[model samples]
Target: MLGDMTASTTPATSARLRTEIPGPASRALQERRAATVAAGVSSVLPVYVTSASGGLLTDADGNTLIDLGSGIAVTNVGHAAPAVVDRVREQAERFAHTCFMVTPYEGYVAVCEALAELTPGDFAKRSALFNSGAEAVENAVKIARVATGRQAVVVFDHAYHGRTNLTMALTARSVPYKHGFGPFAPEVYRVPGSYPYRDGLTGEQAAAAALDRVDKQVGGDSVAAVVIEPIQGEGGFVEPAPGFLPALSRWCSEQGAVFVADEVQTGFCRTGDWFASEHEDVVPDLVATAKGIAGGLPLAAVTGRADLLDAVPPGGLGGTYGGNPIACAAALGAIETLRTRDLAAAARRIGETALPRLRALADETGIIGDVRGRGAMLAAEFVRPGTDEPDPDVTRRVAAACHQAGVVVLTCGTHGNVVRLLPPLVLPDDLLDEGLSVLDRAVRAEAGR
Candidate 1:
């Protein structure tokens, strides 16, 4: 249904099953990957993808599966989007890498300009590009420290910042991300984050508890920055209750600590807003962004108050490939698509279509403990029937069932009991409906079991 594909095209069908999930061809590739790939680099589904377009992925065995994860919230405009493809091709032909740090280019400056206009601030802003979200987050911390002349950085519970040594200290999870990766960076402190579903507290109440801990344990005045994801990502798509962000931001201002919003997963219209902080009218001093910024290219940025970023020395904040020309080109095209298509509203329509269905499913299935999220980023948390205890086994089964049925779904959360759906904003309504129908039956069967 993207562009003008004929109905007879092999991979153009909304969703098709040519063979069993991970059919023979994919199984063969799996055997090859097992021998060469690292054990820690795991994938949700083992199917080997050959090509992707719009909402469908054509696998090695000719199976066409619907994509619900969007490469972990990348490809938001859609896979191989025409605008992105064109820009990438044009940029590749002209030039690829002339690192922005050595020989600055317009694409890099243009992307920074776009970030200035698009991010949730009307004040003068500056940005430094990076190669990944982790890099951007680390750089944001560096900028905050340099600007505020403080050492302590405060993060929230159930947060997933990154996997780098410094970011691992900033991250709250253990196991796969931070386990055995000590000793981490120093001066990183953790406090409570708002989770209305589990904590059962109003935004102001949760904020007070967190602020109290910050003041008592960390001493807010000593804090360089308070970093948070407007909505938690890998710890589950936990959108904080209303007013929590505003309260923390005000506290940061009063305490002379910078407020940093990690918008890596919630930015670029993925949450029906350019940045999630806009939802609560909260303006952070620095915002780290990535994932959906470049339509699949690896491009990250730390955009914030000009004074904060300007405080850092020139050589103190750059990398060899921080803003690769090709990635910047891709970002420009992706941003253009988001603006022209009004994908922010499209994301809202996606939420409108999917949330009700997910909520109805929650009501029908006792295992579904909660259903929450915004825009195209929604999730269903699984729990043992009649209890709030997490049911990760059932969650895995449901996701496996969806995969076998030619639908790709991803699971997240500290307990691994969440099924988070992040469909591309450009996905056709019929494909989304069909994918949801498959998910519905999968959940019903698994819950019935």
Candidate 2:
């Protein structure tokens, strides 16, 4: 119940910004954090939220802040969704824990079954459950290595795979996620991502260059899997070039490498489809999903080809708390919600509305170097005026200004200069416009200063 118990049953209609960005309550929390909490754990904006629903977070001090970040895209269905709440209540009342591995349940099986049917690749598929995106990613690598009988795992530059030791090795960042931690998992490799804005490489060219690097470095044959975030979340809302994914898929096939798409942040309609891989019609050997999979519950899953997944011997990949009954129940409810509401289409509609305005902003403001993303998973990367050089300082100023104006914004990128916006698809048009206006004002004001 990460953000649960603190959510308001009713949505905040009037968003109020009081006492600057980190108001009194948030300031107190920050003080407590520095004193009591481990320095290893930190926060960007220490706003203590008391409640959240739809697209607003109510701070402990009664301030309503528009949630553009969607709790790191966790609540794509929106906070405290009625469908998810009902399921959680019913499941908690009936049965909460009772680990899947200890005593399997219908809910667990149903989620996996749903995954098999939903993920890309018409071929037979299978799935395993885990607790977080990192865990799911780790399990995916395990499966890939076991299936291919190879030890080398290829990751991409600017990738943010999780904070676990194995996933840490898989991740590319060094400061926050991998700074002090060392001696990470071995046999992991990194390749250039198809970053059109920076690398000036088309999807096909980028893919070719990456494959060539793999050929020279890991010799493709020695690689077990090449895991990528279909639409990178933490490494900025970067989408692989149109041909990049498919080309990589072809290479993996030729080299006998398992293709793993870490769709933890882009799945469950956040990217306007069941998963972003479907955009290019490319299917990976394995898919790791989490974040939006269970409405807001803590659940992650790995769905892959049946033969490759089955390569793992019986009782090979599992966890004590993986796929708890409560999480499974929540996931079932979430899937039903997505289908009934057609949230994928909803996400596309949101993107349609947001893209034009963000693009217009890019045209008007030289600081906005690029706007990229698919569906509701969108971002605006800020740079110095008339230059592609990322400006993290301006990004922070704009984000803070948004907070002061009653909007919560999240900045992400390799240089920390991208202000990502993952608003809930269920957001009302008026609210969405209002949030956009705040962003506009914040950007304008920050640039003016």
Top candidate on TM-score is 1
Which ten-residue region of model 2 has the weakest summed lDDT? 1-10
lDDT (CA) per prediction:
0.92, 0.87
lDDT of 1 by residue, 129-176 (tens): 998999999999999999989999999888999999999999998988
Alpha-carbon lDDT of model 1: 0.92
RMSD values for the candidates in order, in angstroms, are 2.4, 3.5
Model 1 misplaced regions, further than 4 Å? 1-11
Q: Write the per-residue lDDT of candidate 2 for residues 204-306, one digit (tens) a residue.
A: 9999898888899889889999999998889988887789999999999998999999999999999899899999999999999999998788999999899
Instruction: State candidate 2's TM-score.
Output: 0.96
Top lDDT hit: 1
Per-candidate clash tally: 0, 0
- lDDT for position 326 in model 2: 85
